[model samples]
Target: MTINHRAEAERHLSKASFMTGDGPNATPVNPAAADHYLRMAQVHATLATGQALVADASAYRAALASWRDIVAHFVAWGLSFAENDDEHGTYLRLAQRLDEAGLNIDNDIDKITPEFGKDPRGMWKPPTVRRAEWAAECAATNPPF
Candidate 1:
């Protein structure tokens, strides 16, 4: 990734970090997991932006893979911090962005959750569930969009 692209990704990830860690309505949950996932997302975003700037197909694929990993991390964190609606929705949007970018690791909307669904109230679950499901899906699927 170019320096500028990386910097841009850093900025976005920083935004995600703030959203995950500290907010007026932020959930008082696992700060460690929240920081981890948010930082992962930032890495993915940086990879994606860098690849886009260079127009490299291999880098693009790598970036997509990174995004998938970030989604998995988000799900795991969500489960551990079940009451953090802000973080839940934040990761949901990140997953959606990955999908829109055509990563399509596993097009399971359930994995993404109701932040984009019809539910007004957000929900949370255990990290293990999302971690196991993501591992199995990545192992079995061929990037199902």
Candidate 2:
């Protein structure tokens, strides 16, 4: 996984872990923890897939370092997110890291769909798979490592 993505996941996981522990209100907190674990798993899975697609060691290392920084921020925040809506914050931070690293997330439907123009509807099918495929395609082109 890219470092920034991992960091974001780690941050969420840490907060979730704390919510499962002594976090405020304690009930909804567990639900959030569940969400956190699921999201963490998703991030890890995406990273693994990206790693398999990339062959550049240096790029991979840099991505890993970025994720560590994100996780560190989360560790520093502890249970403070318990009262705030921080879900989108992680995505924003991750985007920032990718931007700083000159990495582009494959969310450009226009770019990805145009290539599939021959297909029915002239667009990619199933938004989730489309996103994943676009990301993998982008990774293949740039090779993050």
Candidate 3:
């Protein structure tokens, strides 16, 4: 008549794991206890991935222009105030993101301040402009025939 505490603990641990749906495709051993935080992680994993990247790569990146516009609108439209030294780093990072996204800023001095500058060059353009530019380039090149 021997008692095994470790075996009993292991059994309980396994039962808890299954009840909480702890692993991928794990069938709930105790369906009554299926509601747990572990499922939140699985649901977020499906939802939080970058779904905005489904289109053509250029268009996907170009679509970031709308985000840039929103930033600019806030920077210009917000309440008037000067910048603080401590918050300069955040503005610097924001400025760098605009530059990294192929947008050139005017009023370069304001970039270091909280306003993130006043002007943005090379902003969004319509697809028709791209088509016309492509047509011009194609005409400039000699025909293969």
Q: Highest TM-score: which candidate?
A: 1
Every model's TM-score: 0.27, 0.25, 0.25
* CA error at residue 63 for candidate 2, angstroms: 19
**Candidate closer to the true structure by TM-score (higher is better), 1 or 3:** 1
lDDT per residue as tens, model 3, 1-145:
7434344444444545667444667654555454332354344444433322433566867777666666655443331121442243354455567778777443433442245442232112223443576688898896657
lDDT of 1 by residue, 5-63 (tens): 45565665665555443555665544776577577767777677766766787787898
Worst 10 residues of 2 by lDDT: 75-84
Count: clashes, candidate 3: 0
**TM-score quality measure for candidate 2:** 0.25
**What local distance difference test score does each model get?**
0.57, 0.52, 0.46
Estimate the TM-score for candidate 1: 0.27
* Ranking of models by lDDT: 1, 2, 3
Residue 64 in candidate 1, Cα distance off native in Å: 4.8
Look at candidate 2 and give me any clashing residue pairs.
Answer: 1-47, 3-63, 3-66, 3-67, 4-66, 4-67, 7-71, 56-145
> After superposition, which runs of candidate 2 have C-alpha atoms over 4 Å from their true positions?
1-3, 20-29, 48-145
The RMSD of every model to the true structure, in order and in angstroms, is 26.9, 26.9, 20.0
Alpha-carbon shift of residue 128 in model 2 (angstroms)? 66
How many angstroms is residue 28 displaced in model 2 relative to the true structure, after the best TM-score fit?
8.6
